[model samples]
Target: MNWKGHITLGIIMGLPFISAPEQIFLLVAGALYPDLDHDVKSEIVQRGLYISGGLILVSILAYLFRPEYFNVGFFIAAILSSLIYVIPYYAEHRGITHTFFSLGVMSIILGYLTFKLSIISPIMASLIALIMVTNNNLLGKSIAISVFAWVLYSMISTSFTTFQGLKFYIIPIAIGYLSHIVGDCITPMGCKALYPSNYTFRKKEGFFGVAIWALLVFYVVKLV
Candidate 1:
């Protein structure tokens, strides 16, 4: 999915579980996660690396100057989370970092980092990672009904009102990200859903493409 779709999906999906502030942070982070591995030519890679590096630097400064800036610590946690998911770039396409396994591993790592930084509870961080990862996988499909179902499932499963509860942020973020992928999947160029699973869906030409584009634009605006 395009950037807009990714962000929208993140926000819509994350809305029920997190405060507006937390949702914004997760949407930005999740939207940027996939591009962390982009090469020099890719805008996502360039922006991600710069943003990650900047966040790390800011975190260090915050830690040194004002320990009360505990929130800045989450930025550091985000950088570390990206690093864990982005390393060994070769494993990216091979589905190592893109699967449920990597999702669990990275969530644990992120949860620990967040706990150490005292930014959020370890459990919250873990749930957030899980939501983001699941959404990422769902976004790669082309079927609208399937995409809607995925979003519905995420909303139903992760919906929560308090942080002390199940923490619905992850599920919404996942649905948002997945919605983007589904949008992309219906494009003429298509998307590889079930990558490594040998399943692919092609887009129908004409109005379907136009409709998808419209929906994409709507979500993008919503997310941004």
Candidate 2:
């Protein structure tokens, strides 16, 4: 599946749990992140690196201004997150990044970064996530713009304290990442989510994909 499908699946899967602006952004980021292993020619890969690079710089600046707040742990976390984006440079397309191992690891890193950043600097985190969502080109722009506008409204009205805990952010990352793997699994090429095992998790696109979407939508409706 393509980025659009991956993001749509992520949103649908996460619909019931989304109660805040950052959750939506996290879901989008998680869905798009697996594609980071794509070639340098892929726009998602380049833009993801750009976002990670910018995040590293932002963390450094924040530390320089207030070591007491940003601290060494925060600085190290930023570097670790930035390194994730760089993995694509040396990784093969649909390689390690598509695996469950990467999914779990990325969820922890990104979840921590977003959680800490939102707690200490909501606006900065919001803006960075906004960029991460909106950089996926035209389709992404439309989805991100609408959701980001909602986030901005929430920020103005509620001071953007909507997300409060680590688990809240991590849930979206895990679900979104899993949804991306599922989406790719339905494609003819299948997915090597197990990795290191040459086994491919393949499925028929039409029936299986529709069933997955239908089940997810039904669950979302049940929540509503």
Candidate 3:
């Protein structure tokens, strides 16, 4: 499935957790996260490089002039941006990144990073950066605005400092990540969710797949 389809499916998967705008944005970001492994020929790889370079430049400028704004967090974010570009540059399309293993690992890393760097959620920044680099279209803008609003709310609210740790994010991240895998499973190129086994899993063909997804969405919506 494409980004739009994956994003829609991801939202449905995360419906039960969607009480706030941040969760919605996170869901969207998670859906698109798997495609980070696109080949070098892909526009995503090129954009990743640009985003990485931009972050590095910003980090340097902040260090020189805005020292307070620059810290280990900025350095860590820069390193992450570089990895985001480098890893996808060498990764195979729909390879390890598309697997459930990658989903869990990424979620854990992001969860930890966000908590460890509380002054600035690298998880949100990195994912928002990915959103920007991924599309640069209407969807990206929508997600950005949502994230901006969430940040504004956080700053205005008392919960800013008392932010809960990894546990707060693990569920939504996993839901969104797994939703991406499920979205790909409906495609002709089925997803190998359980990697290292070389087994591909897909939904039934034709209307059956659509029906299953629709039914699931309906059930989830009802519960929500």
Candidate 4:
């Protein structure tokens, strides 16, 4: 899915835990995370990577040197800009990277790291990030079922851990990530719904071709 879709999904799904301002940050990061790997041949890849790296660096710097003036708006803009370019360059018409398994793996890894660092509530941030990555090509019912199953398993298995909020985190992350899948469905390069099941969907024309310019405009306006 695109950055707007990512942001919208994050805001919608993250409402349960974080405030509106934080939602914007989480959504933006989610939208840009997939573009960490970029190639020079692809303009989106080059630009997106630049933007994503810049945002991450800026956020880190702000957190370290000027916590009081950390501009969430700037962070959000960087994220949206990066995703706008990256989707077409790297992720569009992709495979598991746009699937539940990929999203789950990313969530687990990031969640663990966040937990270790005690950064921004690991369960909440991880869930938001996972949700942002999830695509919607998989049946909504199937996604829901999967999320529920994971939640149950987490609650049961991690009941004794301090990260007991894993269950609560799973639902939103699943939903948010699934939202990306759903958003991609509207574009030409559809997502692979039954990833491990070998089901694939493709759109003749994806959203990135024309939408990138618009996304840049919107992001600039938002920044202003």
Reference-based lDDT, residue 127, model 2: 47
Give lDDT per model, in order: 0.45, 0.67, 0.63, 0.46
Residues 80-195 of candidate 2: C-alpha lDDT, one tens digit per residue: 76666677666788888888888898888777777777876754674455354344363456356438545555554442122348877776777778788888887888878787
Q: Give per-model CA RMSD.
A: 11.8, 6.2, 7.5, 15.4
Compute the lDDT for candidate 4: 0.46
Q: Answer with 3 or 4, whichever has the higher lDDT.
A: 3
The candidates, ranked best first by TM-score, are 2, 3, 1, 4
90-146 per-residue lDDT for model 4 (tens digits)? 554455556667556544443333333235665465444433333343123333443
Clashes of each: 7, 0, 0, 8
The alpha-carbon deviation from the true structure for residue 82 of candidate 1, after best TM-score superposition, in angstroms, is 7.1
Worst 10 residues of 2 by lDDT: 155-164
Q: List, residue by residue over 29-106, the lDDT tens digit for candidate 3.
A: 667777877653357667767877888888899989999888876677666656655755676888787787878876
**Candidate order by decreasing lDDT:** 2, 3, 4, 1
* lDDT value for model 2: 0.67
lDDT of 1 by residue, 1-224 (tens): 55556555555544543432333444334433443333422343334346667777777788789878847547756677557545524444323333333434444454355346334554455334434333344334322323454455465454334443323344333334444444455656554444446444446532353465456445543231
TM-score for each of the candidates: 0.43, 0.70, 0.64, 0.41
lDDT of 3 at 196: 83
Off by over 4 Å in 3: 39-41, 50-73, 112-133, 141-163, 204-224
